[model samples]
Target: MTDAADAEVRDGRDLYVEHCASCHGAELQGQPEWRSPDKGGLYLAPPHDESGHTWQHDDSMLTDYITRGGQAVVDDMNVSFTSGMPDFGMVLTDSEITAILDYIKSTWPDRIRATQAQRSQDAWVD
Candidate 1:
């Protein structure tokens, strides 16, 4: 019999494949040398694994990231430039976004999950 956690992992994998794997990578490993600057000059794709900064972000911010994509602000100007990331708000429903986030959370270790929970609570207030 498959473990419940295993099932959850499978669901997460499905979500990742349908929504995130395009840029984030097929294994949640993110792009190559994701932490380093790439030819485009920005960091490629940072890992969402425990080694990544995803744990440092909160749910609210994560939600915004999925909804708004990434914007470049220079000298107080907001330029609606295309980012490596896309806004999933249109392509995927809120529930789907939530599922994607759930999948990410499911992959995290306990300590990271707890920290991210705190970050989620603090996510836009300060």
Candidate 2:
């Protein structure tokens, strides 16, 4: 198999189908009532598109969210308890992860990308 750098993620639409469509919806619209919590007080999967707060994080953070899963890295069991997002470290090869990430980056508009880039840079300082 080729390396992550060698692999091409193509574009957001394709990536969304492979990596996110099952949970997030084919159009990145996420689940219905995604913002509202479930009966267990757990939040449903939220949208990754413009309507979502996904733009709040930078690329690295997003990567960590994928690799480590937000709950694991955040030191919060509650987050994990509520979050349906799974850890892909064992499931996805590094290159696949990178490609998925690239796909996510492709989805964002320039402004969001720039903002995310800056946040990722700031993370390096801490």
Which tens-of-lDDT digit does each residue in 31-84 have in candidate 2? 989877789866777887767877787666677778877567555534345666
Number of the top-ranking candidate, with lDDT as the measure: 1
lDDT of 1: 0.72
What alpha-carbon RMSD in Å does predicted model 1 have with respect to the real structure?
A: 4.1
Task: In model 1, state the lDDT of residue 125.
Answer: 63
What shift in Å separates residue 73 of candidate 1 from its native position after superposition? 8.6
lDDT for model 2, on a 0 to 1 scale?
0.71
- CA deviation > 4 Å runs, candidate 1: 1-10, 72-83, 124-126
TM-score of each predicted structure versus truth: 0.76, 0.77
| Clashing residue pairs, backbone N/CA/C < 3 A, model 1 | none
Task: Kindly list the per-residue Cα lDDT of model 1 for residues 31-108, writing each as its tens digit.
Answer: 777766666766566677887787787787677777767542221246533346666777877766776787888888
